[model samples]
Target: MLDHFENDMVVINDDANSDSVQTDDSSRLTTVENPTLITTTNHQVVKLQLNATSSSHTKCCVCRENLRDHAVKITFQDRDFIFLSRNIWIPEVARCCSGHLINNLLSKEAVDQNKPFSIRYQELSSSDVQLLLRKAQTLIEMARKDLVSMIQEILMMMNVVY
Candidate 1:
């Protein structure tokens, strides 16, 4: 029999074994293979526990360290030189031991925004300089073609009958 009490524990009366299960506030009972458990509230005190497993170790891509429960979601930018574009990724990362994000990627504007839960940023990588050069070449070629077409259009307009 399961008795729902006003406390944070569930009283179990096993008739088959005739055992008396005594649960205390200090000890917690959890089912195997899952972190989330059934939680109950008593006197406005919510009791909940998350079981940590081997897979629970979340690593930060920048620092390559395991993350803890208290973490912030940070936005990271990746510039691929071959693609001529920038990519943004928002990931939940753990703060470093120095109490700062890895590589100091967090921007000043993000700090001024005062959103402790989330931070946004954009960064220009060194490799993207090559991509910018390529983009500039493409733009120059397009402009040269546009200028030739405009000159041809003006010549034909002047030759037309009034």
Candidate 2:
């Protein structure tokens, strides 16, 4: 009787093992093999740096004109990170002009004709700045995932089982 029970247990364990292997296989099938690699070539990095530095000279989104002389300057910090590698990217948007004043003027002209002259400057709130940082982080995460997946696929192709 004990021998029969032991045999049953062994069958049960084998069934469980098979089920787990099937589950793992199905899960792996859902993942794309050798996903596209994220390339950060030196030229791309230089382009990004140039864009960051020249953002101030770009036309203001609201006014569609080059920044005025002596325009109030605003700065925002952006960050990026990769998971497969230990690289941190922190880019700065410098000397950008705020457009809130022009918006306010237009709105006030429509609402009250005799209002005192006043201008509002649109400044990035702490939360808005945080959002920018979060975006960078997300990009980095995507790059990292792509890199890790590519490395994994390469290892598999080499018959590396780990």
Candidate 3:
């Protein structure tokens, strides 16, 4: 339960939790903060720092053409797939020519042609790390399921199914 105040501050009317909302006049946001949820937010906010130039780029990463308007940021799925499969890490902030990508992922030609700028360290928040791990697990599970289904099909072809 919550009790409202004149200044829009809220008081949690509970015996177990004695939390009070603070009113920020600047942002006009009232929040009941918890120490453990300092880094948590209603929406996903991933903080990443990579030693690569991502802004004010004249040349595209895939082709050596002067970028004017048709530039697109590489999608997360493409980055994760390329990094996991090829061990080449492309920063999330990196952009390339729109022609080189399909649905924000690198085209087949671009995947074969473009390479990483250089080896650099990338920082990710805890939630981002967890998301990456979950993605890897899901990919692995999908591959396992595909293998199992294929094996079952092969066994059926050999009249082994009950």
Candidate topping lDDT: 3
- Candidate 3 residue lDDT tens string, 1-162: 222222223333333353444655553344555433232222333444332433325677666567879878777787787666666676656777888977667888986666656646555555676788898898889999999999999999999973
How are the candidates ranked when ordered by lDDT, highest leading?
3, 1, 2
Cα RMSD to native, each candidate? 23.1, 23.2, 10.2
Candidate 2: list runs displaced more than 4 Å: 1-123
Query: Candidate 1 clashing pairs?
Result: none
Task: Quote the lDDT for 121 in model 3.
Answer: 53
Best by TM-score: 3
In candidate 1 the C-alpha lDDT for residue 136 amounts to 57
Screening candidate 2 with a backbone cut-off below 3 angstroms (N, C-alpha, C), the clashing residue pairs are none
User: Candidate 3: lDDT of 54?
Assistant: 34
Candidate 1 CA-lDDT value: 0.38
lDDT tens readout by residue for model 2, 68-152: 7644433222112211122222123423244423532322221222121222222343344456567767778888999999999
Whole-model alpha-carbon lDDT for candidate 2: 0.33
Candidate 2 has a TM-score of 0.27
